[model samples]
Target: MKIKSLHHICIQTECYKESKEFYTEILGFKVIKETPNFHKREYNTWLKLGEIMIELQTAKISTNLNKWSSLNEGPVHISFLVEDIHEAYEEIKSKGYNNFKLKNEKEIYKVENGYLFKVKAPEGTEIEVRDQQEI
Candidate 1:
């Protein structure tokens, strides 16, 4: 079978409020829906950024944050296409959310069609922003 398209990316957050703020206020994702999870104790927030959708899931029970690591074996990162990588990177930095501290002169890498850089979400997930041009 062939995969058709991505429906959404689900992120398990240790702190739901921080994750929501980072995705909404920092990254500019809009909240499409918010509902209780299967257990009905915690919340699951559905967010939209352009055509991309993401689900922020709150842990049902208290857990150690140290267990989650960006370098873990599961889904490592999420990438987004931006109109201008430089402008996006600058905006992210100006907002005091540049956990990666990427330098434009060294960190931003050139791809076949554009440039790419990575930043971290509040939960420490790597979020890549790429700017591509029609060639």
Candidate 2:
């Protein structure tokens, strides 16, 4: 089967309020839709950033809730293409997200075709901000 495009990335979080605030307030993602009490005691929110969409879902089964870590075997990070890496980093820091650790000793690292830096969301989800333009 040929995939046309990425529809969305789904993230399950135990701290729903923190995750929601991080994505919406800190990262400036807009909420396209929200379903409160989606499955009784859980919330489901859809956020949009440019053409990318992310679905933030609260744990449906309490017993199955697990926290994410760098040691996890599945997807570890999500990267977004920003227009300016420095401006983006400054903005995030200015908004009191000072806990972010640089992916490299340098504030920005060079990729094959871009520059990138990583930051952890409130729940420790890795987020990479990149600019795909030669410096």
C-alpha RMSD for every candidate: 2.9, 2.4
Number of colliding residue pairs in each model: 0, 0
* lDDT of candidate 2 at residue 27, scale 0 to 100: 95
Q: Residue-wise lDDT of candidate 2 within 87-132, one digit each (tens)? A: 9989988888765656556767878887788888876788988898
TM-score of structure candidate 2: 0.86
Q: Which candidate leads in lDDT?
A: 2
Off by over 4 Å in 2: 103-106, 133-135
Q: Tens-digit lDDT track for model 1 on 89-126?
A: 88877888757636566668887788888878877788
Compare the candidates by TM-score and give the number of the best one. 2
TM-score of each: 0.81, 0.86
